[model samples]
Target: MLAIIGGSGLAKLPVLEVTHRQVVRTPYGDPSCALTFGHLGQQNVVFIARHGHGHSLAPHEINYRANIWALHNQGVKGILSIGSVGGIRADMGPGTLVVPDNIIDYSWGRKHTFFDGPERPVVHVDFSNPYDDGLRSRVIAAVDAAGKQAVSQGIYACTQGPRLETAAEILRLERDGADIVGMTGMPEACLAREMNLPYAHLCLVVNWAAGKGGSATVDFDPATAEAGMNDVTAVLQAMLS
Candidate 1:
């Protein structure tokens, strides 16, 4: 089965045909919410809203370890994480969908690894390529099948946040070659790697990054996010079909 981790603006999947809900327990702690077991067309999927169902959890406050462990324990073979991001590149703007090929993590103060503490031996997982290649390709194909255009590859900058980035910080990320910026992309991607789960991230650009696109302030519109998620739903449905 495939696992889907829904980030900001995707508290619930639009295409899911709900089968049941499960509150999975893990050694780490509770996941963000109950796992929704459902069918997207004929495909079986398990989903978790990264933030709480009401969108109360901040990026740093999310229990990444527990969330990952819950899905891993449920025997999901692959994971697809969907997030809302700000456009840093000229081509990335509101409503644009992206399948990021790589990522840069600026996030901190979260439980990033399972390989910690006195009993566990330190293990180094190769992160030379952060995203799973095959899954990325499949998402790209799904976008095509969904009749939606997506930036095939880009660098995602994961920032620490309850607050959005400062103008200077956005500038720094752009200099670091980040094409998009978002809050919840880090440990989630790496933790999936540690579990050897094939994982891919799909992003929706909801606004221009701070100080970009001639906007003095970052303006976010819920309507834009809703529209972008509609596109994400189409791709996921196509992926399942």
Candidate 2:
């Protein structure tokens, strides 16, 4: 089964056919909420809101371990993570959907591994090529089948944030070769790797990064971000279908 982890604007998948919700308990703790089971076009997909359903959890506060473990326990083989991002590269403007090929993690102080305790043996997963290639291809194919114009790939910068980045931080990230900026891509992707789950991401460009485009002098506009998310929602529905 495929698991879809919704972030930011997506709290629930309205298109998912009603089935049942299961609250899973893991050694780490509870997941953001219950795991939602449903079908999309004959395919059974599990949906979980990375933030709580009410959008109460921050990026740093999300239980990455519990979320991955719950999905793994529930027999999920692949994961499609939906996230909202700020475009750092000029061509990736608002409303663009990108399948990230690489990621630069600047997040800190989060539970990053499943090998921390003495009870569990020390384990290490390869960091190179973080996202699964075959899964990424499927996502790209899904977008093409949906007839949505999506950027095939880009480098995602994962920052530690409940707050957005400053102009200087955005510049630094750009210098680091990031095409987009987001808050919740860190341990989530890495944890999935540790669990050996095939994972891919569909990044919705909600706004321009600080110091870029029209957002250079002002804060990100929520209205614009919401509109972009609404467009991506349609693409998501088609992808699932």
Candidate 3:
């Protein structure tokens, strides 16, 4: 089965026909909340909110290890993670939907790996490509099928958060070849990799990055976020099916 991890503007899947909710406990800890099992256009799927249901957890505080473990234990083969991002590339701005091809992690202080404890063997997983290529192709096809113009690939910059990045930090990220910036993409992506589960990121451009476009002041318009989510949800549902 497939799994969906919702972040920020998306806490629940409107397209899912709810069947039940399951509470799971992993060796790491409890997941963010109960996992919802349901159908999206004839496909059975599970979903969990990356942040808590009330949007109470910050990116830095998320239990990504537990979340990934819970889904993996449940036999989920692939995961689609959705979150809001700040646009860094010229063509990616508000209301844009993108499936990132690569990522640069600048986040710290979060539990990053499943092989940290003593009982586990010193396992080193290859991470030359963070996002799964096959799953990304499915997403790109779904975007086109849903009639939305979604960018096929870009570089995601994951930063330590609870706080937004400084203009200088964003500039550094751009220099590092980042095309989008957000807080929640690091350990979550890595944890999924450790689980041997294929994962893909579907990002919504909520605003411009700190040093780019309209983010000099504040331009995270709610209307744009809502509209973008509405458009992408259709594609996501199609992808699941």
- Per-prediction TM-score to the true structure, in the order listed: 0.98, 0.94, 0.98
* lDDT agreement with native, every candidate: 0.93, 0.88, 0.91
**Ten-residue stretch with the least lDDT total in model 3:** 210-219
Model 1, backbone clash pairs (residues 3+ apart or across chains), number: 0
Question: Per-candidate RMSD vs. true structure?
Answer: 1.1, 1.7, 1.0
Off by over 4 Å in 2: 214-227
Put down candidate 1 lDDT per residue, 102-130, tens digits, no spaces.
99999988899999999999999999899
TM-score of 3: 0.98
Runs of candidate 1 with Cα error greater than 4 angstroms are 214-218
| Ten contiguous residues minimizing lDDT sum, candidate 1 | 213-222
- Candidate 3 lDDT, tens digit per residue, 16-120? 999999999899888899999999987889999999889988898899999999999999989999989999889998899989999999988899999987788
Give the C-alpha lDDT of model 1.
0.93
lDDT of 2 by residue, 151-184 (tens): 8889999999988888899999999999999999
